[model samples]
Target: MAAIWIAQETVDAAQGGDRQALESVLAGAQDQVHALARRILVDVEDAREATQEILILVLTKLSTFRGESAFSTWVYQIAVRYLVNAKKLRARDPGLTFEMFAADLENGLVADPPKAPDQDLLLNELRTSCTMAMLLCLTLDLRLAYVLGDIFELDHSEAATILEVTPAAFRKRLSRARSAVHAFTAQNCGLVNQSAPCSCPRRLPAAMASGRITLNDYPNSGEGADSFQAVKRRIGSVVDALKSYELFSAVPDHRCPDDIRHQLTEILSPNI
Candidate 1:
């Protein structure tokens, strides 16, 4: 029921304050909520905190859900409202300009290849680090639009409903977002162009040193430098077929971390 839980009956039950149904709904929806928040928010820590708050907010507001939209769609609306506040509280963190990114390219950033094939941990780190940095580069509305349209692949009408915007407005926002990201990545990211000078591995040291990453804070997922290259590849190459957004999608999803997920589960479990 949680996985494909669009049945109006279950939604009605949950809305009616049925504890079990509410628990089931939240549990099933966790991954999606976590993923969206993580992408929109600044870091895992912020994302995790905001995710827990999002769940609680949804729990309290679920009763207000009018059922005019799909339950999942309604959930995203709540998620957006909660995250909007969270983003404002974040310290001013506009990322490098495209000119600076291009400078990194001209300066010839290089990726250090992972030693082994099973270094899934480093691959995870690389993907997370790069994607999070990229997301932080975007303005709030654009970031939200990009996540819903490009990463999550929400259609304009459905995404607009969740955003409370008309399809035309949503498309315009997404278009602006796509243009900004495409401009940067087409020249910078290896996922979009293998020949690009920067690679996740090469940037990893700087990120960790600068405290942009702190695997030490979380449960050891074996993402440390010597843990083998989780996504082991020796060289980058060009890919002509895929668009930049599709290339951006190649980065894996590192949703809200485990500790936060469990904390939420514990709080919501009794309700269930």
Candidate 2:
């Protein structure tokens, strides 16, 4: 039924200004539109906006589609264009904070990776790990590509079409995006800079929370070595937390799944 509605006959009639046919196409494509919006925008409100815009554009530009690709692909193509533009616009807005994004991230939820929808414990654990800030830094194009490729596990060629890029180009972008995401995760997880000043233990967060000493004090060379030790202890606490959580374990090796990591990133992201 869905395939029939989005087929060329329906699209042709809809483009001919047939309102009922247009509605049929929309009804049929609604799920696809929402899924694409959510994956690309990672925010419910943004997803809805993107979906609305995509539908409208599809309706308005139906005649321009020259049958170069599958109807679904064309629809996704339009959605991807809108999403890319939206991300750029949002990034420019100084008032839009990570908190807003995190809150909105829950919109247009899709099936989890590994098809574990019944695993509520895993989902809850992953939700807690969702970090919004890190997610935001993962450029708009990267997010689209990552979702289509990694989470949805689409092949390179298909993902490239969704991104409107050549397969090789898509692969390159995916590689870079994956690397950047890893670095972002490592920085937030405090694993890459094991010895760096910021790479301290998690216990120090308690000190930070208490405000016993200013963070600036640790950087001052003239400040007594005691202040430095306090910094070290704090750094240690962070490291210990990472170790305890086994955040650095190889993929599929740690108790915490990627879903959980994604969740943590979302939660801590707003604070950043």
Candidate 3:
């Protein structure tokens, strides 16, 4: 997916104290910021909260933006700084390890899982959740490197700028993250390795039983979506290592919740 860029004119107007321009700037940034937060933070609620706080920081710091970078880059710099530190505030335990995740994938899988009314949707939910859990296996710095450099497809220099690290340092971090993810998925994920034991269907029952596949709260649930089979067919030809990263790119882009604008407006009401 292409990165969303806010027009410099709009940013300028917002910085000049135009309320409508400010709203436009924030609206343009909301989804990308929320998506970054979602990728970095394991919990949906924590991501949402972090997005709000990050946007607020952007608004407050708008005057400090000197336009040395693209507006999106500047916003992302703020976001990464906040999210890297905010990991500690996450409600979910941040102790997930690759060994633990691999074991979880192998545990409680049913030979022939019963069908759900919306099996495709449920499976998609499980697949997205499982992939996200895999990300949690990485440490905060490595996870951010993978999310920005690999999953979001940001350029190494740009991603490094966002993280305030030297390009070589960022590359090293991304390399480590990629190796860990590739090693684990190549051994355990059916999508990457057809010989692997853990397929989405076989794991759906365990996911449902563990309350990790709730239908109503599915982050990627939408109409006219393809099943995992269709998704597999689309990316089946890619090399294994790239395919593991593509799994993340293939998941639908997550939108900021509907009430976010309203909530932002409420929070900024006194100033606006």
Candidate 4:
């Protein structure tokens, strides 16, 4: 009976019509799918939709999953296809432009913080900065390579697999992406408010303003709360400084905020 049960599972998967098996496969790769989709869609609701489409494509195409590359690669390829199509579909509006993208990025960079702290303003800024269409249009290989490479700290080789390219090719793509981002920043520097930066009193986190959290009291407080708070204040100070920095003047690389700091550091590190 045990032998028969094992055979049944294998046969069901081979048939490729087993929805449960397909769902199981997708469930196992859920994080990977969401990450890729988020890189493409950016917006949470739209990313969710794109992810569903990618999963459906994977299920429909599972029969073609001959033991070629790993199943994850196959799924990523499918995801790339769906994401490209979705982008093309959205592009038909005819109103999209670099200006629109810059506006989106600048505005998104400081929008509403998540209702919760673990998913708060900083994380929102990080996501918006990474997903801004200005950055996405930087290449044809999808936006995964750039985001994963710098923002998420994924290695070049790992990024290459997600991008479906060799590490060397991935490096070239990253270079081009960085160049495009620089051009975008140069072109939009005039628009960033230099007079009042986003460090508005309202947006400043409590820890940054008062410095009273030194003695975080809780039954099971994490070991480094004080250190983390210090970093938060430092980041807050940077944001506050942007309000007064002349956007039109040459932006010193050292002054760039965390969102695009890596790119700025690469270009300005030598000058500094």
Best by TM-score: 3
lDDT of 2 by residue, 1-272 (tens): 02213778887876676666666666666656665555445454565556666766776677788878778778877877877676654664334333354343323333232333323333222322233223455666776776566545566887798787899989988777666655544544333345322322332333334453234332112212223234324435664334322231211211111232233233432332
**Candidate 3: C-alpha lDDT:** 0.82
Note the Cα lDDT for every prediction shown: 0.65, 0.50, 0.82, 0.45
| Tens-digit lDDT track of model 3 for 194-263 | 8889988899888888888886667644422667777777657788688887777677667888788667
TM-scores for all candidates? 0.76, 0.52, 0.93, 0.50
Worst 10 residues of 2 by lDDT: 248-257
Sort order, lDDT high to low: 3, 1, 2, 4
lDDT of 4: 0.45
Worst 10 residues of 3 by lDDT: 217-226
Which pairs of residues have clashing backbones in candidate 1? 119-228, 119-229, 119-230, 120-230
Candidate 4 structure quality by residue, lDDT tens digits, 1-272:
00001233542473444544533454455556665555455444566666666665655565676646555556666877676667653563234455566554344233444333453333233222322444446444625565656544455775678677888988987776655555554444323333322322223243223431223221112311233233334334543223112221111111111223233223432332
RMSD of 3: 2.0
Best by lDDT: 3
Better candidate by lDDT, 3 or 4: 3
Candidate with more favorable, higher lDDT: 2 or 3: 3
Backbone steric clashes in candidate 2, count: 27
Q: Which stretches of candidate 4 lie over 4 Å from their true place?
A: 1-20, 87-137, 140-142, 151-158, 161-166, 179-272
